[model samples]
Target: MMPVDANVKKIIAQPLTAEAFQKYGQVVSVPRGDDGQSANNNTAKRFNFLGNVQNLRSDAKANMCVFRCQPVAMPFHMRMLEKHQYSNQMFSPMNAQRYLVIVSLGGDEPDLQTLAAFVADGTQAINYNAGCWHHPMIALDTTIDFTCFVHENGTKDDCTVTQTKEQFFVHI
Candidate 1:
């Protein structure tokens, strides 16, 4: 029973596959702008420790949307601890809100679907595993600031388990 010190030579991020994460959540790509800017609006505004904002809406027809941030980020190196590997902790959803990880850093593209490789423009992209550990930003060009959209449901186990670390590589 001792603490293990490891070196993180690199940060790996890869496209989340339905096969790898079966019964888990789906990976939907955020729409990008045409030739230049971002097309999707609704991105959250970062306020920091200043305060927290919570919005819960139920219009009966519109669709119940939930956005919650633990204010957590990807550490320098992501490693699977012993705790997460044994229990069903590896997979299990805190809530049932559909999430969307939108990026505005440089030219990194979203994994709209496929294995999700950036079109290769120098910019970096990121993919989240419902809640499986991920390195916030792939870091290729600009800062990686994102707003995650999650759902609000009594659904206890929304995340499924897999047997691999986050896999990401440059296409260029």
Candidate 2:
């Protein structure tokens, strides 16, 4: 296997915009609460994309919620691998599902070549250009309204899951 440093690739900084946005739709700005209100930690930061409410569970759901991720390397002097987590099921329509991610808080810029590996051509998403890799999905937290595309052929694909154990330390 390649050395730890060899496997680690510099994360490219990308943004979620009409030009960069792969999925076409009426964009809804998920209002983020106060800056200081967001809990911060070494592992990652958590936030409620929407307002909280009470709801109940039921049979399986058929809906989709997608978001974008970006690389923010300016916070770190050295680039690190982007880590992520995922679940076996999808939560949509009427279920409270949630996913958390640690963006590349690093205050630096990544090269275009690095970003070449990560791109969504046609998908509904809110890009998070943190550069750092993050969990694919944690699923629902509470019932929420979401809409997105679904690959019906069942041959859905993502570039690939290149797993690695890379820890990042963010100083507040």
Candidate 3:
């Protein structure tokens, strides 16, 4: 862990909306009505190609993972932010539960002043663009399971973590 800075920023979580979240990534939610039919003859709502699922180098490969995350209480202090330089990351909730999504513009490093927070219901998921800075999983209310997609290889280039000079607290 890094040393905490003297500055603290308070962030109020707002309702997640497609328009607001577009800059960071796509908001993946089940579309209304049946858009397509799967081979099983069931109604299917597909959100395709939400993000760039590729490795930074040709030698690496992308993989899918299931994460069971415990819920974090409100007024949680955010100490660090991370980004995947190689591939885009996607998170889809396996259960219907509300959660918090915090993000900042992608760059060589994270800018605390640009941090934004959004509250997402179980119906909503997100595909963070490559290099997008974001806080780690922040499940709320109850424990939740998420299906994650990203490049996986034993390399430090996969993810980068930066400690903030100023602390931020997320409130719902």
Candidate 4:
């Protein structure tokens, strides 16, 4: 609600885990269990129901994309955040060392006080819930490619962007 200030909030990203990220999204990874059944004639393991996709609009269709993200320097300054009001966005790392995921809890805009950051490895993936406020995917150390999935109707409402009241610096 106010103009951006000079004060910078510092956040140290913690390891990404299901319990820690439950309120904002679901972490997609290999489930720990022998529940996975053998597939392809005992050559591969198949785990079902890892996560669900959220598409709340009737006219919207699922869209899959690949994003090649460049490495970001340490103490990354975060000035803006975005959210998909009608569909959940998922990103699966193809080849990444470690990446940062920043999110917040708010109604109309991001609440700086509620900002949280997490570091996810290449083996881990995440699916942000619809309307969840989050910073754009941040690649650290090396360039990474991600397979993303979301729903879109070819309109501005597909994604909502908002400027933060204060800049936040993300530190690993």
TM-score per candidate, in order?
0.24, 0.25, 0.87, 0.93
True-structure Cα RMSD, model 4? 3.1
Ranking by TM-score: 4, 3, 2, 1
Considering only N, C-alpha and C atoms within 3 Å, which residue pairs clash in candidate 1?
13-167, 13-168, 14-167, 93-158, 97-151
Candidates ranked, most accurate by lDDT first: 4, 3, 2, 1
Q: Show the colliding residue pairs in model 4.
A: none
Number of the top candidate by lDDT? 4
lDDT of 1 by residue, 46-153 (tens): 222211122232321212232233432333222221111111111112332222222111112222223322221212112232332322223333332333433333
Q: For residues 1-172, what per-residue lDDT tens digits would candidate 3 score against the true structure?
A: 3334556678998999888998888788765563643644455445455455556777667788988989987788888999988788999999989999999995887876778999999999888888889998899999999999988576898889999767888888
Tens-digit lDDT string for candidate 4 (56-120): 99999999999999998887888899999999999999985789999987878987788999999
Error of 2 at 74 (Å): 12
The reply for model 1, stretches above 4 Å from the true place, is: 1-25, 30-76, 79-131, 151-172
Error of 3 at 76 (Å): 1.3
